[model samples]
Target: MNGAGSAKRPATGEAAASGRAVAATRTGPGGRPGSGKSSEAAEGHGSGPGKSRRFQAVTRDTARPEGGGRAAPGDAPAPARQWPLLAVLGATGLGLLLVAFDAFRVGTLLIGLAMIGGAALRWALPSVGMLAVRSRFTDMFTYGGLGVSIVLLALMAQPKAWLKIPFLDDILHFTVR
Candidate 1:
């Protein structure tokens, strides 16, 4: 019986290799092939259940722009020119400044003009870069509405009776009260 048991038992090196083979073939808790937790650890999945896969490092090219080279990974995109938007903004700012100096008529006119121009730009241009604060339709409606309101307010601002809309006073009184 001792001789038979000895014959059946593998040598140390062979037994170690056979043990590794059996471990490799064993399925994990999920019964999926190669899903064993031990294999996951061997494949660089950490020993802890919460451990996530490690990220691989990426190499970037640092070639020149003039030589048809790609931009570096961290490089920021070039700013787009928005002359029309700048013009409108400048006009509106100037209008406010004028109002501060008590040039009410001129200031209101300038502001109204700016709104009208903004509406025109939205209608004509497919893309307004940074100037596009809202959808095209909304922008147009807001600009037009503000422009018309400013013009109407400016016209009625004078003390002259002819400039006043008949129903406006009643509406204003009703809303204000």
Candidate 2:
């Protein structure tokens, strides 16, 4: 076998199942049982064969989201490219600071709005840098869902709730203790 073939071929003398011998093609590359001789079998990811088996995603690197490109042009400074992410982070940080300083309601409101705003920006912009996680629709859904949830929870926080629905309280009545 050539060098490439040697690399591609799994080492022999390795096969088993709880100390019992198994077939070669069934044992997988590491001689580990149920390790997936084919990538789709082992990893349960639909990336198919070939490249999927070679990727050690847990230990190595994570593939960026489909739209994880620069917010600005390539020639622009790094900060400019990541302005979307920075804006979201800065707002969230400010919200956290306000909360730490004992301004709970306003702080939480700002935090939730910032997330909602981030979602809006992600939707409006083509290149949002780190703000782009997963595909565009997925990112939008995740950010919008979380932001709405946070905002709703903030508005419904104890004492004198602002946006109360009678049925909502009844649905969540298990927390009376």
Candidate 3:
């Protein structure tokens, strides 16, 4: 066949195998799998003139600027202190232990107080490390609201009475049945 016809035919024999090897070595940026010119440029070769242009563009885009790609030494934020959150967590854990031992009234009070203290700490401190699971306003509202609710519930629990919600007993009776 003529040269044009031969070129149109599929690559076979040694040529096909070598082509596959070349394709396999053409890895992209970060050595990830993709089409780019860096692999050819790295081996001091190019598929065509376009390959060199692609390599130049890739290098230009990835080049770091004047400060070496990091903030200056004094520009970093200080590390957060965690003791106040840990103390609140410890108190809540102790309160749970008290509840397990049947000291329900005192345990509930302790838990509620701990929650209130956590809310106070969240309000007073700028950051609470891992304990700042939510925004400051959200943390304060949730902690304070739950603490007040728990304290009220503890005060009005079985065998005590300072206040009661109407129809709650009826709802409980209906649900239990």
Note the clash tally of each candidate: 0, 0, 0
- Candidate 2 wrongly placed segments (more than 4 Å): 1-64, 173-177
> Where does candidate 3 clash, by residue pair?
none
Compare the candidates by lDDT and give the number of the best one: 2
Quote model 2's TM-score. Answer: 0.64
Highest TM-score: which candidate? 2
- What's the CA RMSD of model 3 in angstroms? 13.3
Q: List the residue pairs that clash in candidate 2.
A: none
Residues 44-135, candidate 2: write the lDDT tens digits.
44253233333342343577776688989999999998999999989989999999999887789889998998899889998899999788
Model 1 global lDDT (CA atoms, 0 to 1): 0.61
Cα lDDT of all candidates, in order?
0.61, 0.71, 0.62
| Ranking of models by TM-score | 2, 1, 3
- Residue-level lDDT for 25 in candidate 2: 41
TM-score of each candidate structure, all chains considered together: 0.50, 0.64, 0.49
Q: Provide the clash count, candidate 2.
A: 0
Among all windows of 10 consecutive residues in model 3, the one with the lowest summed lDDT is 64-73
Pick the winner on lDDT between candidates 2 and 3. Answer: 2
Report the C-alpha displacement of residue 156, candidate 2, in angstroms. Answer: 0.7
